[model samples]
Target chain A: MSARILLVEDDEKLGRQIVEHLTEAGLEASWLRDGGTALGLAPQNWALLILDLMLPGAHGLDVLKRWRSQCDVPVLVLSAKQDASVKVRALELGADDYMTKPFWPEELVARVQARLRRPVLARADRVECGAIALDVAARRVFVGGAEVELTKVEFELLQALAMRPGAAIARSWLVQNVLPPERDGTERTLDVHVSRLRKKLGTAGAQLTTVWGIGYKLKSEDVA
Target chain B: MRLATRLALTLLVTALPLTVGLVFLRERAARSAELDALVDYARGRMESGGREACEDAPEIFQDPPFRLPGDRRFGGPAPRDPLGLGRGPGGPGPDGPNAPAGAGGARPLRGRGPDFQQPPGRAEPAGPAAARFELWAYNPDFRSDNPAAPALEPALRAALERGAVLASGTFELPGRNGLPPRGGLQAVLRMAWTDGPCAIVLARRIDLPAEGSLLLARFGLPALLATLLVLVTLFAFLPFVRRVRALTAGVRRSAASGYVDPVGASGSDELTELGRAFDTAGAQVREQIERLERRERSLRAFVENTTHDVMLPLTVLQGHLVALERRAAANEVPDPSRVREAQEEAHYLGALLENLGAAARLEADELPIERHRMSLNRLIERAVGRQTTIARGKGVELVHALPGEEVEVEADVTLFERAVSNLVHNAVRYGREGGHVAVVLEVEGDEFVVRVLDDGPGVSDEELARLHERSYRTESARRRHPTGTGLGLSIAKEVCERHGFGFQLRRAEVGGLEAILRGPRAKPGGGNRSTA
Candidate 1:
């Protein structure tokens, strides 16, 4: 079955073009002319949400946040404003990724594919890297089948690094991914949480090795 | 005080003395005329009295007894004891020729009364005749010891005989017993009877006439002194008044006009000095105002260009990105190659926007770059490493030729990296396929030189001349490359300028473009490397 995406945009021509492109890319896109319809239809049966920041009825950021509060559907924001603050703000508001306007159609498709791929692992209910096993639905962690008590932030930080195992995840990217939507904290706060997670996980945490001048990356037992 | 007032003062000073002198001379003439009239009246009265007295009686040698109020008779003869007009008859009376009673009696006359007095009537009294008026006359003829006596008696006798009216004349008088020497005498002789030959002679000392000449002499000095005082006083006071007035006028004019006349030109004085000072102050104020105006205009131009020209292009670029993204989402997969081309365009557009924003910030003096001490050799290596893929993709050999030693510089790492990145990007874009691009760093004296030389279609002379101008891309660069913001060189230039470094673009020896950036060395006398 094709993934369903709710495409929210105010510009009629741009909306039609986006819908056509997504359909051709093998994704069923439900085009909505405003943020209101997109938000209303988001929980019904959509795989992901593609939102334009300049939207009618409700702002894209507001819609993204409201939908995020109710469900865990991935949201990808398309913004025309080139200011870095806007991109950073959209990403912080539970958006999986943000693409500035005038971006390549292929790049947008790539980001959407990446976002959709994220949930397939999520449905497995548990992920294991070396001795560490994270039970997704239960929000619990285990080291070699021995349950370990982990704080919510520490669990999220480990999960974010573990998801892209062997690839260096920049600290900024981890902060954007791991932090909760409404949590107001700096990127350094993420480092402290990572350190705490390392302590709690003990031997299982050793797989989370820091890549100097880049970021943190998790190594599987086979690579170790 | 103005020039007019000063001029008026000067005129008044000169006219004042002349006016006073004219008035003084008028008064002196009036006084002298009055004195001359009084003298004439006295002489007339004496002549008339002598004639009247002589005509009244002749041969009244017994000395007619005559009394006139305020008059004492003397000269010629003295009456007997009954009249007591002269000293006793043989004791120097007119009857005794040798006695010369008139001389003795003249002394009594001198002490008797005032010379003239205003009477009640307008008509004055005539002198008494010898017959009706008592006469005391003196004859110095018998006094042989007196030299002036002999000439005086004959002159008096001749006056008495010839005269119908005796006129006053001056003659010499001789001094007698116990009298001081007398050199001159004034005498008049008249007949007592018209028919008779009898005569009476009256004589007085001539020394008294000299007193009238002395009176005129006494007034001359004071008159001259008054004229000199007026002249001196006027001359001394006039210049001060003129100077004060001129100074006041100069101050008023300067205040009114808001500018001062140059000194010495106005007038050669202290006021001229004051004018020069004011003029200097005015010139300074004008110069400062001009400088402020120039600065304001420059600031205004900077703001206008950033807002209107720069922001418009950035907005357009963002819109283009949005359009491109929407096309790719509908995975019709129309053409994968076209999609890749569009993606590359979007990337270039983003870069262009960022560089434009950075350039604006630099022009507005708002860009903030963090400084760090980094080795130039390491910086060049990193920049080269990033550009290696692109250079190889273009089939261009990228080479870094440098010495082994470290070349440290104090700089903003990010901005400096960007600047070097732009230079390499330009080299790869314009370099001929399979051609070589070289980055060479060398230490010359106190400076570190980084030269980027590429074998490409080089810029023309005109393009090289204006290479650093914002948004000014050469025709050759535009023709050779399909993609560029035309702002790379400008941004690089701004960065180099901000860091106090010298940037130049010239024709290379390899017949391609050679760009150079020279900056002050971080260490003194430290041998640094040449990096390509």
Candidate 2:
């Protein structure tokens, strides 16, 4: 069954365009133009919600705050506001993702797909891909049944990407979590660490691809 | 440590040295006074009668002219001092034969005050009483010739050898009646006669049994005083400690409540001043929080309004692109008006983006403005070129007037361009259809001026003055574009203020609003572009 998505947006053209994009990506999407009516609907029935702020009847944050108390459904906030505080507020209110307006439909659909895909590679103590095997609980990794030594930071960076294989992890997020505070987290340093990690991984490093302006993605397809 | 505990500990700890020091000083003073009185008694006895007895008759000099311990010839105790020099300060009580005068005066005296004369039928215990003092004599060669004399200490003999006329020492004597050994004090004195000098020794014993009684007498009062001092300080210090704790709790409460709670301090002390200082500081912190909160509220409003304004044109631009994509997908001819509409929407979107960037850069305020020589001539021409599409979309003629020579200002080029763009966009977006907007760049005296004049329906005189308030839109502006951000002109003003430039908004002679930016012209050859 195709996954169903709920959209709460007041703009006519943008809402239609988003619905078409999701439909073209083979997802069933239901659109709600009024925030008031959308508040009455059960969010649990849908696989995901693409909620827009600045609605007519009710603000998107209020709706998100109310729904968060009763359900664990994922919420993707689509707002045109560029202020950092507003995005923080939306995420703090329990939004799974926050995308600004004037976004390419491909980014929206790709982000939506990434949000819907639960991490499958590292669900248990041991994760076995084609060539790389990870002992997540032990914080160790192996290539082709041979132990591969990795630094703590390098292991964390690989584990973060490997958890969601082929999905880009943000450089900002990686800098905040993977790097030690003593590293200072400059982008240059991050690049240096990544290059060192690739060198350490040897030929299996081919699976790690830089997503250009975004960040790194660990592809399971080329790991073998 | 807690305030009250710290205070209690400090008070108790500080009181210890004082108590110990005071007690030590009291003990030293009491012992010294007792020693002085004992010495005085011993010396007086030896100097008056003992020395004369040795000088007049050396045969009975050891016993002071035929007087024994309980002799009764001189009377019950001994010869009384006619000059009253025997009694000394801090002497034993009046019940004893020789009591202290004044300091230990007015005792029973035991009838020995007027020189040892026996009363009729009196049977006084003279053994212990007369044992207090023992007198002996040493010849000029330092020998005690009497066979029954107590041994003369070598230290006293040496003192005599060194030419001292009198010397005294205390010693332990055999106790009578099986009591513990008694203390004995002895003194030696020298007498100069026709023949030679005879050393006379006078001695008095310090009472051991009476020591317990003396301890109570000398130490009891001061002990009580020290106890009182410590108790009073600890109790008095309690209030101060309690007040400090209360003040701390009040400060914690204020911080927990966003520095809004007052300490409600009372009393007139240093602690009260401290509490008032905390309250004052808390009030200032509360004011700062409120100000930050107010700024945050306005910033939020501006962001939302900008998003709405940008989104409207953005949606139009996207819709046109989507339509064009659809027409091309089906191999159909494109509509020129729709493409033009898309171009105009794109132009407005670019201007909106520049405004948003300026607003964001202005808000964060971390990056410093890099100054460079910016030509207003090119800046105005670029702004007009950018806004011409939007102006044409609104059926307004966009025009400009440049100075004959290139006019330059020292400013951050990006910020200056954005500010100019915002002004031009504001004039064009708000101007009336079929009316023209003018952009003029010229140098007036020492300042370079840029004017954006429009032929739109002007705002009220009251609203015109407040046109630069953040997120504040006039009634006509709201009516014309219900989703207007009201951020463009305000951001332009902020850029001007940041550059120390003067910005003005007034009614134009062409029946519209006139916006002006006045800045100091750059010095010749001063603005070199930095590689950084």
Candidate 3:
């Protein structure tokens, strides 16, 4: 089935142009001008949310926050203001990516497609790397067939790094993925949690080696 | 206080006391002189009587009718001539055997009864009114023989013995021997007689002068009235002085503090004039400040609006250029024609943004230029290079007929580049589509001239006159190519003005528009550095 997308924009001409482009790109996209209308729609039905920062009823940042509160749908924000702070703010508030205005139609479509494709390949409800089996659907984990207690955030950190097994992810990407937008957790918090996770997983956690100048990556041999 | 009021107050304060004191002193001197005159009159009368007693003894004996014992009138014993009678064994006797006896066998005087008294040794009676005398005189001899006479005080006697005249002072005479008590004026006249120097003091009570008494009676009331008048005048004038001083100080303070004009009028005086001047000056300053502030605010608003509007278009243009560059790089055999078109558009975009920025800076007076000596030939060569690609694309040739030697002139590098670039761009836009354009740089005497010659249709006189006006595009040029914002010549003109160069537009030798930039040559021995 075609993926369901929500496009929120205020300008009628720009919004119509974007919708036509997305439809041609083979995505089932619906256009909403106001944030209230987009918020009323059920999040379970939509695969991706394309938001414009300068909306009428509510700001795109607020809409993205409200959407993330109810569902885990990925969000892409479009803005006319090209300042770097605006892009960082939208990304911090649960948006998966940001694009400045007067952008190419193809690039906008590509970014939206990337956000939509993220959940399917997000790892089978639970992921296993080395002797560590993370049951994401059940919110539990096992280290070498022995049950291990993992906090929600600790599991999220392991899951984010484990998704790209054997590949180093930047520290910034891990913070963006594992922490809520309003949380004031630091890089030290991530390190402390990783250390705790190492103690819990024992030999399995040892397989999570640190990559200098980069971030931690799981070893292929450790995956079962 | 006002200067005038203060001056008047000072004059009044000093003049009032001096004038009143002068008047009081004059009146006191006049009254004292009058008293002295009265004393002199009494002294003259006493001195005349003393002279007669000392010079003539018979004058005292034969002055009036005598009631004596042998006067051939009343069958009494002949009266002894006391003046002719010699001193007896002891002294002169008060009553002798030949002494004139009146009723009751008492001695009588020549003038009247013996009871008619005289101031002892001073026997002369100048007037017929001897009873009117209030004088009292005493000698020890007279007082001892005449038991009815009163004696003088020892203090008075001692003062008389010292040859002091007018020794008598104000005192009450005791009423004795049937005399009435009276207040008197006193005088002591010293006379040199046969008995030697003696003081005949006479006490007479004179009535006080009416004028002196009246003056004394009114002195307190007039002084009290004068004091009250002074107080009333001061009380009335003090508020005026205080109010005037406050107004003066307020005006002075306002003048000292920046541009705060004094409020309200302070009477119709010099202070009012000063206040008016202050108001005028303050108004002028306020007006100037307000005008400057308004200019600054408008300039800021213009800058903000220009930046906002221009940056939006610039951002879109940049994105387009980036995409075009990506496409050009990806092609195995990049289409040179398309690449040239893209680059031209990008160049146009960059030039447009630069001109807008420069115009905004000029309007805001924020851009400062750095000037240096530059070779005009090199500057022209660089300007030609900027348009070489476009000229080649259009199948046009750009010829540089510059002198072999450098022609140095003073100019800012970036501004000179922009000016030359604008001229080249204008020539490329309006020149014949495939015609040749020649740039020439040469020095003539003290001037360096740069000329851009095109082969397009030449402009009319009117068009050439208004050529450098901002956004003034020729009708033919706009119809043929409407891409430019028509600010090239205007910007070039501004740069020339900034560098103190002269700009002239005329028909080219090759039958198109020609722009000439001329200015003073750099000093000899100066290195020619490229400004652009």
Candidate 4:
């Protein structure tokens, strides 16, 4: 199946080249040279939309806001500016992801392919990350095949890491979001919880990996 | 306190004492003048009237008036006044030799019994009359015959002994201060009696009002003067107070506006001078703010120009790389010209990014450089290697040589490489088409010099001098590289400065610009001799 992608960009050369990249990656892509045409995009007709913020007519964010209220197409917002607030504002307006401009053209094609191939998020009773499995409704964790008992803090920490299996979560984020406020949610305490969870997972403990300077990622060696 | 009120109080404080003192002093002077006038009046009355009375009744001069045998007042409280001041020295003028004693017995009583105080133009009889002084007579022996006479006053005795015509003295009556006016003066005069030179005297007490009341009464005028003076001065200082108040408000307003407005000054006075000073200071502050704004504008322009310069080439190069990647993935040979163009753009972008990154890091100066003893030979090799593909794409032959020995210098290796790379890039980019670009690293005259030299079409002598100035570019430079950000040389200079090295540009005899980085003398290692 050919993944249909939409691109809104004003820079003629960059837009043309991005189209070539997406096409060479085996995706059917269409490009719009003006932001004004971005408003008419029907999410059902496209798998993903790559939007550029600095455009010739209507602003990219306005298009994003309008399209998002009516549709659920994944959009990757693009900008040449390195300003963080602009990125934050784009994210807040319902952009699924972002890429700062002047990136390798191959990287954009890869991001587009990855975005199209992403699994849709849905509520499920069972969650699996490599050798670890979670029974969400029962709040139970199983390593390989046998169940491993964990404390409340340890269980929450494992759940946070296993939710996004290979992506590294920042230590500060774990301290603020995953750790209970009453427990000393400092990074030092987080390390203790993670280590305890790793130990308790026993044979599949290798999947609970510590990402240095960040928090942790749960990935079994054979999963990739 | 308010300034006006404080100043008025000062006026009151200073003027009141002086006013009171002046009033008391003036009152005292007037009182003494009146006392002297009373004494003179006593002297005149004795000379004009009392002298004649004494001669007409010479028996009354005998210290006791000779009374007739049937006289009613034969032994009255007469001639026995203990302290010898007349019955009342300042009493009625009739308290003297009785007319009955003078005329009823031995002598013919004349209207001259003792009409001493008779008015100057009146032919009055020897009857009751008002007197300002007491009248008495003295014998040649300094004796008084009047019943009310003081007994032979010392002033009269002294006059008798000296044979002077007249004498006068002042005395405080013993018992008169409370019920009556205090103090009196007596005057004695020598007169021609029918028998001998008899002396007649006049005495009077000077009635002066109570000193406390006199001084208190005089106080009103000086107090009024002082009050009036304070009022006048307060009014006079009104303008001064007003100007100072306005000055305070003006300063606060100027400060509130960030000193953008000038403080107002109108009149030529101290307060105006103060206002002018504030204005000058405020103007300086405004000028500094404007200067900062100008600098910020230039900085912003620098960022915009840099962004435009770097982005266009960056976008085009990314397209080329993607095309090449796709062609390789499809197992097709990439076009050589496109490959060469991509390499050239990559070299250009890499050098520009290095220069910009170094410039930014140098400005922040947060992380101190980690300088290791590194080889300058390695630095030159990398710089030439990085630019070799771009040089080849332009048909330029790039030649580089380092000393046969390892030439080591203490430097942060990364920053030093960026500096050397920019020099090589500029030479390759701006040198004449297909011209030779040579980079040499060698020790010359105790310093290690890294040189990037190119062929003709370099900067002129005048332009070479200006190359040290930040963001300076020549006309030929603009033609060769139209999108130059003009930051490469300045960044190189900053990096060199951070390493305590010298950077210079010169026109070589070979007819091209030579960029030089002078470093410390190379240290020999591995038994290789550094070029001397």
Candidate 5:
């Protein structure tokens, strides 16, 4: 089933654009001009809440704080302030991720998709693609029956991309999911991680292919 | 008047009366000596002449030796001569009666009677006897009908001759009817004349003013000296008083101008030293105010420049949005270029805001850091991983070297990560394409040291020193990242300082720039386990 997102933003044009883009990307996105009506809706039904800091009815952070106490749904704060303190505040208020405004619709959708996918993906203890196997619980990895020592970041990156094997994950999505929020990881940094991940995987690294201008994908050898 | 002048006036007032008293005493003493000498001369002459005459004319002396009352041989007619007999003006001498008696028939003397009163303010003579003398006739037939008639008073002669050669003595004479006995000085002698031996008596009044004159002379000079002392005291301290007044006025004036005025030193005295001290203090105050004003002006400029910078990216993003909208309205597939441009501007705005917020919070002293025990090695890897994609995009290889085990640190995870991220981000942004960027964390002498280095064109020594200044960009940095906010290193420095860590930037060994952050190694159980 496609993920459904509840977006609460005050800016009419940006809000409309984000909703349209998300709908086109084959996700069910409902846009609300204020936070009050969005707060009345059951948060558990939606895959994620895309909240803006500046809203008409209720403060975005307030709504997030209230919703977070009742449920464990993910929240992505899209604020125009781009202030470090604001970002830290939203995260401290139980927001899963935060993005500043004036954002490209593609990056926003990519972030939304990553936030929705993280919970489902995190439930798996073992992540396997081709001969590369990542043991999430033990923090260990095996490539072609040979156990290899992987750095914490390399394990996170491999597990994040290999969650949906053979499917392209946007560079922004991988960076958002694989990197800790406090880290200043960019798309270019994501590329370097992938290259390092490839080297660590050895011959199994061939199964991982760059999507070219989009992101990276891991494929099983039998399917390729 | 100043204090010194008032003091001088007081001295002068006290000295004046003393000086006058001394002068009066000196004058009185000289006059007293003159009067005493006159009396002595008269006594001496009468003694020499009368002694020989009295010896030769003893029998002749019995006939009318004392003057009759009507006789005018003395200074004035005898007291109360009602008939004015002997008013022929044949007085005692050409001079006043106070003069010595001349060589003639010995004149009768008078006491202080109504006809012979002394001047006012004249003190009485020192001796207990009346300061006057009179003669008495020993032969009864020669006496007049006056109440003070002559008595055969041989005891008077015996008493007068019993003393020194001058033979001065006090004797009471019979006064007028119903009057008290009056005392007088008497001098009697016997001397031989040509015929036979005769007895004679001489007497005079002792004046009071002469004695007082002697006392006034004693204190006169000391009073004069006291006046001089007052003048000397005024002269000694007057200059210091004047200098103090001028210095006080100068300091008051200088205070009004924020201590910027110069109080010049003009002498080698203490006042001049005080002036030099004031000059030094004024210079220091002026310099401090100037520096504060300069810093305020720069802070204002920094805010304005930050606002201006934020506007540029916003304008670019607006343009990109307009292009994307027009393409969407045409119902054609939108070109990715417009979207990509908008994203780039958005990213730049985000980075700028982050720097601005960090700098603002750091300066405001409100950046909250919640520290916890965490794996420093893992944090470094994550921080380097965040820059990996960007470094690769710029064709720069990112390298991170860490310790073998978990290096636990008591840190605020977000801020610590941010500090490391800023260094790596700057390295990737300014380092040369295809160059290497390295992040290293290791133990150095009980400190956890983190170093970020890149083989990019490094700054000169001058630029390296200014890297931590807010919004200060070097020449090479400007050439590489034209739109860099220049707040990254400052933010890193502030974070390190807030955490009691040491931070520095220097030329890297890899022919580039290097940033080093050092923090104290965490002790066991010192850090909280909970972290964000």
Candidate 6:
């Protein structure tokens, strides 16, 4: 089930439209005219708080600031004030993310989905994709229920790709996060490790794909 | 002329003639005294028993007396009365029998008769002084049997009657005593003795010292003093002249550069004061010019920022409408997404107008925001509700999470709401599609913290730091969304600051951007607590 969003906004027409749009995108959204009503709601029940910086009763920044101390719900601030200082200030006040005014509806829905999807991914200690299963804590990989051996670099590469399946990771990011401190591996070296890891995986190696100019991605299931 | 030269010239001009006159007077006094001294010596010699030798003795005459050549008597030729007998009519010549032996009468005394011409008391008998002086005796009785008697005139007799006669004449002394016919200045004196009146004549050769040497001795020291005066004047004025020249050059440079560079001021003098004054004036002028330039630059930046802000929304709206028209012309219903996008652009244009105006008012320090203790939660609720439609159109969810208890804070309600609205709108606009935007308020001890977060493509760490700057779009930001007013966060920041709240932008652990705004928590007794 998609997580519910609590929307705090003052304009009724804009408020009604945002709720409708979010509902049509298959996410439940509830609207409030002011920070007073939103501040009474339980943050743990909602996946995200979509907040308008301007409100009629309580300032949106104030609500975000007050509620964040009590609960850990991710907050997304909506602001028509295009000044970056406002965005930075909101970010500093415990806002999880921000969008300037005049954003696409599709972009908004995608952001909501991204925020909802993070916890599901973060809770997993082991990731399984198609015929490959990775034990993240123990740093082990299994292909077709058979264990596969991997070097430290190769294992880290596979783990980084497995964390976000089907998503392309940038080469520079992978080089920064997955490579061992002493290895001093460049992207080219990373590619060599990936090839070696694929060879070790054997049939399961087909799931590892290069994303052209980007780095790499792992797929558990192939698309038709 | 240079000051030193001028000073030297002036001093020398005054001193030169004065020195010359002083030397001339000194020389005259010296010469007159010398002549008087010589006359006194002659008179003294004649009175000290030298008159007795001249009185009735031909021995004083020796064989021949030393005389200057070209001597002419006033009446015809002098009578040859060497023995004081004025009876002989012929002049004494070398052929005369009574002529003294070896009396050729025209030779210097050096090679002539040595024994006869020797003066009685002189030592060094054959030197420059050998023929220097000669003495002649005159018979005052005016009668003589000897043929070599000198004849006297009435003027001489008159001078003798007055006790003594002193006279100077140029004449040749006879070389009869082996003395040359030496031309000399003759000093003759007549005096009355015990026997009769006797006349003694003394003569010395006229070999005067060199005129150049005499002139130098008489004037050298004073000339030296005048030169010294010139030198002293030059030395004294040289430094003053150099300093004056430096001052002039500094002034010229000041004029050349429009009073930009400082003039050097050294020493505790009047010129130093002038230099200091010039430096002060120049500094003031430079500061004024710089201030003007700075003002001009800021004005230019203001205009550029205004133009950029105005054009962005218009361009976005135009682009959206064009795409919508294109879709409609292709025989399809205009997509709801396109309509919502155009509406969002129109909303952005409205916001841009409001924010730009508000920014102006803030800069002019005329924004009137009344502050009072108000419910911070209620303000956040109103802001979130205001941004809900845009958030929905963008498919971004707006959420507000707050404590059930009322979060009271001191603020201007209208401005506070606008600040909150801008933050939420920013999240809805920049967050990824289907990503969630949230408003959450937390209470930490005595502070109320409000945060807005979004799960979207967040900025780099470097970009995050610079995001607060007005209208600053990073490279990735410009590529992602080509249209934005770029004033939302800046206005929100202004409102929060005006309300004395702490504000910051940070990275969210939820993998997106976070904005934080903090203010003081209200007291439990419903009293306001100040944060700033």
State the C-alpha lDDT per candidate.
0.57, 0.66, 0.58, 0.64, 0.61, 0.64
Using lDDT, rank the candidates from best to worst: 2, 4, 6, 5, 3, 1
Candidate 3 local Cα displacement, residue A168, angstroms: 58
Is candidate 2 or 6 superior in DockQ?
6
Clashing pairs for model 4 are: B84-B150, B86-B148
lDDT of 1 by residue, B1-532 (tens): 6645565566567656655675577555643432232223223323434333333432221122233342445333332333222123223334432222334433322212222221211111222111112123332221222122233355545655564345344444456565444343244544333233223344332231232344344445554665576567657767756665665676566556544342122666665666666567655755666656655654565455444554544555565555556666774444544443343344444545545455544544444554454568656765565556556656787765443245777665546756776787677666778887777766666778887878788878777876755442222222324332246676777788778889888888777788899998677344321111
- Which parts of model 3 have CA positions greater than 4 angstroms off? A1-224, B1-12, B27-42, B50-298, B301-305, B321-402, B409-418, B425-439, B444-446, B453-485, B494-502, B506-513, B519-532
Instruction: Provide per-model DockQ scores.
Output: 0.02, 0.01, 0.01, 0.01, 0.05, 0.01
Report the lDDT tens digits of candidate 4 across residue range B1-532: 9998888778878997889787778666644543444444434433443344456665443212333323323211111123222222222223343322122222322344333223211211221221233345566676555555567567656765787766666655555435453455555655544234354444444333343454345576677787788778878898889988999899899989989877788989788899999999998988888767765765564575468667877898999999999999999999887887787777677566555545545654445665655557645655666676677777887776554345777666557777887887887877766687777766665688777777748776666666666442222112324322245676677788888899988876567777789978645553222111
In candidate 3, what are the lDDT values of residues A29-58, reduced to their tens digit?
A: 898999877766677678888889887878
**Of the true interface contacts, what fraction does each candidate have?**
0.00, 0.00, 0.00, 0.00, 0.02, 0.00
lDDT of 4: 0.64
Q: Look at candidate 1 and tell me the lDDT of residue B309.
A: 51
Mind giving the per-residue lDDT tens digits that candidate 4 earns over A1-224?
79889999998888899999888888899999887788776766888999999887799989989889988889888876644356556766778767654455655775676578664556667888778889888999987788999888888788777766665556666787788898666888888888888789886787877653234677735342
lDDT string, candidate 5, B425-472, tens digits: 788777877887777776655678887887888888777765655442
lDDT of 6 at B73: 13
Question: What's the distance in Å from true for residue B213, model 4?
Answer: 14
Which candidate, 1 or 6, would have the higher TM-score against the true structure? 6
Give the Å error, residue B182, model 6.
Answer: 99
For B1-532, candidate 2 gives per-residue lDDT tens digits of: 9766776677668766776777688666644444444455545544544444455544444432232234322211332333232222222333443322232222222222123322211222232122233345556676655544566778987897787866666677677667677664455555543133345554444344442354455456656776787678778877877787788898888889887778878999888898899889888888878767866865775677577777788888899999999999999998877886797676667666766666656765545665665556656765666676667767887766554355778776567777887888878877777887877776777788888888788767777755655431332212334223256777788889889999888888767888899989887567552211
Q: How much is the lDDT of residue B40 in candidate 5?
A: 46
User: Model 5, residue A73: displacement in angstroms?
Assistant: 1.3
Interface RMSD of each: 15.0, 19.2, 23.2, 21.5, 10.0, 14.0
Per-residue lDDT, model 3, residue B395, is: 62
Q: Lowest-lDDT window of 10 residues in candidate 3 chain B? A: B124-133
Better of 2 and 6 by lDDT: 2
Error of 6 at B155 (Å): 99
Model 3, residue B427: distance off in Å is 4.8
